[model samples]
Target: MPRRLISSGSTFEREIGYSRAVVDGEWIFVSGTTGFDYGKMTISDDLLEQAEQCFRNIQAALTEAGGNLEDIVRVTYILPDAGDFPKCWPIFRKYLGDVRPAAMMISAGLSDPRMRIEIQVTARRSSGS
Candidate 1:
């Protein structure tokens, strides 16, 4: 199969020259998605809300790339404040506890101060499972 690029219609994607997700063969790689609702381009100040929105954005990209959260093999979480990460656990567990993909969390600076959380994931389509 040929490589495919997926877009979430975020203006930043066009301005930054990157795809929201990329599909190649059986693998799908979703970019680091923030809490911003792309349609409204707004983010929440609460960490839990932001975390939920991040997963929603990632799910949208994964769905467009021909897979779902169950297919995810790895996940990377970026948070500007390390202290805020624990507060997001309940929300994270809601979406990923069952799937339990390999995950890592890092404290880092974000492009936007309002962005409390960003998530990126990689998935592989199962064959005959």
Candidate 2:
């Protein structure tokens, strides 16, 4: 199957020249997604809120790619402050408790200081799904 590109209509994707997610056959690669709501381009100041929004954004990309959270096989989390990570565990469990994809977390800086967390995921569509 031909590769397909998905967009969330975020200006950043256009400005940066990258798709929100790319669907190639059964595999989907979702780009690192921040908390800024694509519709309003606004992000909350709270760390938990940002983490929740990150999952929501990722879910949108995965859904557009013909999959859901359950399809995610891997997840990578990037946080500017490593100390804030423990505070986000509840939010993480809320979204991925059952899916439980292989995951990792890294401390890193983001292009925008407003961004506290960014999530990137890899998912595979089940056959006959």
Best by TM-score: 2
Which whole-number lDDT from 0 to 100 does residue 56 have in model 1? 90
lDDT to native, each model: 0.91, 0.93
What does candidate 1's lDDT look like per residue over 71-116, in tens digits? 9999999999999888888988899899999999999999999998
Stretches of candidate 1 exceeding 4 Å from the true structure = none
**26-70: candidate 2 lDDT, tens digit per residue:** 999999999999999899999899898899999999888899898
Q: What is the lDDT of candidate 2?
A: 0.93
lDDT, residue 97, model 1: 94
Report lDDT (Cα) of residue 63, candidate 2. Answer: 87
Tell me the deviation in Å of residue 19 in model 1. 0.3
Local lDDT at 12 for model 1: 97
Model 2 residue 29 lDDT score? 98
Per-prediction backbone clash count: 0, 0
